[model samples]
Target: MRHVIALDVGGTAMKAALTGLDGTPLYEERRGTGRERGPEAVVESVLRFAEDLSVLGRERLGTAAEAVGLAVPGIVDAGRGVAVHAVNLGWREVPLRELLGRRLGGVPVALGHDVRAGGLAEGRLGAGRGTGRFLYVSLGTGIAGAIGIDGAVEAGSHGRAGEIGHVVVRPGGPACGCGGRGCLETLASADAVGRAWSAASGDPDADAADCAGAVESGDPVALRVWQEAVDALADGLVAAVTVLDPRVVILGGGLAEAGDTLLAPLRAAVAERLTFQRLPALVPAALGDAAGCLGAGLLARDLLAALAVRT
Candidate 1:
């Protein structure tokens, strides 16, 4: 069976799969990223994991992988196949595609931003399926987004296109890791809500899930925190909708797990903020955590298609 290696490298874990050309997974595995051992160790771990998967594919299916696709967190230069920077992983200008290609005996490799890759899967096979235009946002430890057009996610000219998290929604509110104040993620991300709830509940270990549970139980303090986050998120999203005009907005990641508790109020908030722009259908992501790996498989398949066209 001819297959491709698809990997989604997160800050703390990596999800990998050996996938058939039709996007079915033949084998799947997950491993810790080992960032605590340093970036070099993390890269080595990824290479070893891919090599093991390749070997496993050959042993089980009687063929080697034809290509590889990797989705990683950080500032990615997809056109250049480089990972420019990832604060969490401490990577800088790493030629990930070239490195993987070399390690895998020169097989073609595609590298992409994790959020963009997830959005690609979501747009093509998940919530945004059949939609011509949409935005995919992940509200995790930090917020990030991907803009989808037609069947593909746009990486923008500089591969920084869907950075909605850094958009200034509150001007002078809170400091952001991106060196800005009042960025959307600072107020709306899961980490932000956890912090706020921790303070409000006077429990240092409180997190966003706890906050959501509290809100579900009708706790006034949790409601306040949740609403604040929702308001900030709505502000940032309106800014995006004003510019992108996507027909659908797909919300994913940890915070999105709140389900209707998040969406009901969020839909109302976004609707209230809109004036003349078309209201988009706000929906939950369908793929869950599998999106990035599935998207990496799609990337590998697309690379093979492009190569076939060239030949």
Candidate 2:
């Protein structure tokens, strides 16, 4: 049976899976990124984990994997197989493709931005499957989005297209990690909601979980903060919908865990903003974090097969 090795490297952990040709995931594992230790250490850790996975696949699946697909958080130059930059991972201009290819013994390898892979998964097999255009927004510790058109994730010319978090909504509202002020992410991300609620409610150290709990218990401050987040998200979505006219806008990441609390108000706010424009269906992402890995596996499978034919 043909198999592929898939990995999604996040700021916190690197999750890997061995998937069959039919998309059945046979195994999964993860390890801390240890970014504080530097990029070289992280790369070595990833290589060791992949090597172990390759060995296990041969033993358990009775065959070696054909290729490996790896996704990371950053600006991935997919065509060139390089990681231009990943601020969260502290990597810059990493030759990720060549390194992985050598580690995996020349098997075809694919490197992609983490969220782009997730967007691809949504476009191909999940909520946005039938939609020709999709805007996938993820509100996590940080916020970002991806644009998928014609069943493919559009990775812009410079590989920095879907960086919707940097969209300036409030002008000088709040400072962002990207050294900017008043970004949509500073207002609508889960972390932002939590911090906003915490400050307004006199709980200086409250986390996102606390904010969610407070919202459920009908705390006035939490409700206000959550509402504000919804409003900001709605505004951002309005602009995105106007631009792309996507059939569906898929939400993923930590904030999405709020489910109805996040989607219900968001949907209402989005509805109120639309005029004659086609109202896009707002939905939660089905695959979650696994979306990237699954999409990576699919990409690896296709790429390796094509490369084999070319050779």
Candidate 3:
């Protein structure tokens, strides 16, 4: 059976799968990215990984991949087939699609931002399925978002449309990696919450999970930290809703793993802030960590179909 190679490349690891055009998985694998070795090494690792998957596909299915889809974290210029930048992976202006295509023996390849691709999968196949308009927010080490319209995720004019994390929630507040002060990510990201809780609890190693546990135990300091993060997140979401008017908001990532501990207060806070804006349904992501892999498969299948139509 014909299949495609789907790769979701992260800062620390790569998750890959071989899937049929209909999105049925035939094989899956995981490997460390070796990012500690530097960006060039990481790029070589990705190329090598793609080659390995291609050989495995041919050996198992009697044919190589028809196409390949790659999801990478960074400022991606999908139109140019380049990963503009990713701080964690130290990638900058990497022509990932072209490089992967060459490595895969010229199989057509599609490249996309990881978060946006995950949102695409969620909107079409997971939590946001059938929702006319959706916003998929990932609150992990850093925060990012994908704007889903109909069955697709919109990349926007500059491919930076759903960057809700940089929305300034507090003027002159915490510094953010984006060179902005008081950005939503500075306050609401899992890393940010962990930092705050660590300082308050004097644990030094306290993370968002620990903060959630403390809140469950009715720890006053931990509850304060969690609520602050929730409030900041709600502030950002309100601004997003005021502009995008999405029908649903799907929250995912490490912080979201707290479940209702995070959602209930966020919902209430967002509700209190809204005046004329329509309230969007808040839900957790359905695919967990597998969303990116599934999304890469979807990207490859869609790209192949489009190419066939054009030819």
Q: Assess each prediction's global lDDT (C-alpha) against the native.
A: 0.95, 0.86, 0.94
What TM-score, computed on C-alpha atoms, does each candidate reach?
0.99, 0.94, 0.99
- lDDT of candidate 2 at residue 185, scale 0 to 100: 93
Best by lDDT: 1
lDDT of 2: 0.86
In model 3, the Cα lDDT at residue 301 comes to 95
Candidate 3 lDDT over residue span 166-250, tens digit each: 9999999998989999999999999999999999999998999999999999999998999999989999999999999999999
User: What tens-digit string does per-residue lDDT give for candidate 2 at 1-311?
Assistant: 67999988888798899998778888998788878899888878777878898899999989888899988887789889898888878788888889888987887788888998888888888989988988999898878888999888888998888888888878888988888998999999888987887788788888777887888889887888888888988888888888889888999989998888888999999999999789888999999778888888877876877887999
Candidate closer to the true structure by lDDT (higher is better), 1 or 3: 1
Candidate 1 Cα deviation (angstroms), residue 197: 0.4
Whichever of 2 and 3 has more lDDT, that candidate is: 3
Candidate 2 ranges with C-alpha deviation above 4 Å = 308-311
**lDDT for residue 208 in candidate 2, whole number 0-100:** 73
Candidate numbers sorted by lDDT from highest down: 1, 3, 2
RMSD of each: 0.6, 1.6, 0.6
User: Considering TM-score, which of the candidate structures 1 and 2 is the better prediction for this target?
Assistant: 1
Candidate 3 TM-score to native: 0.99
RMSD of 3: 0.6
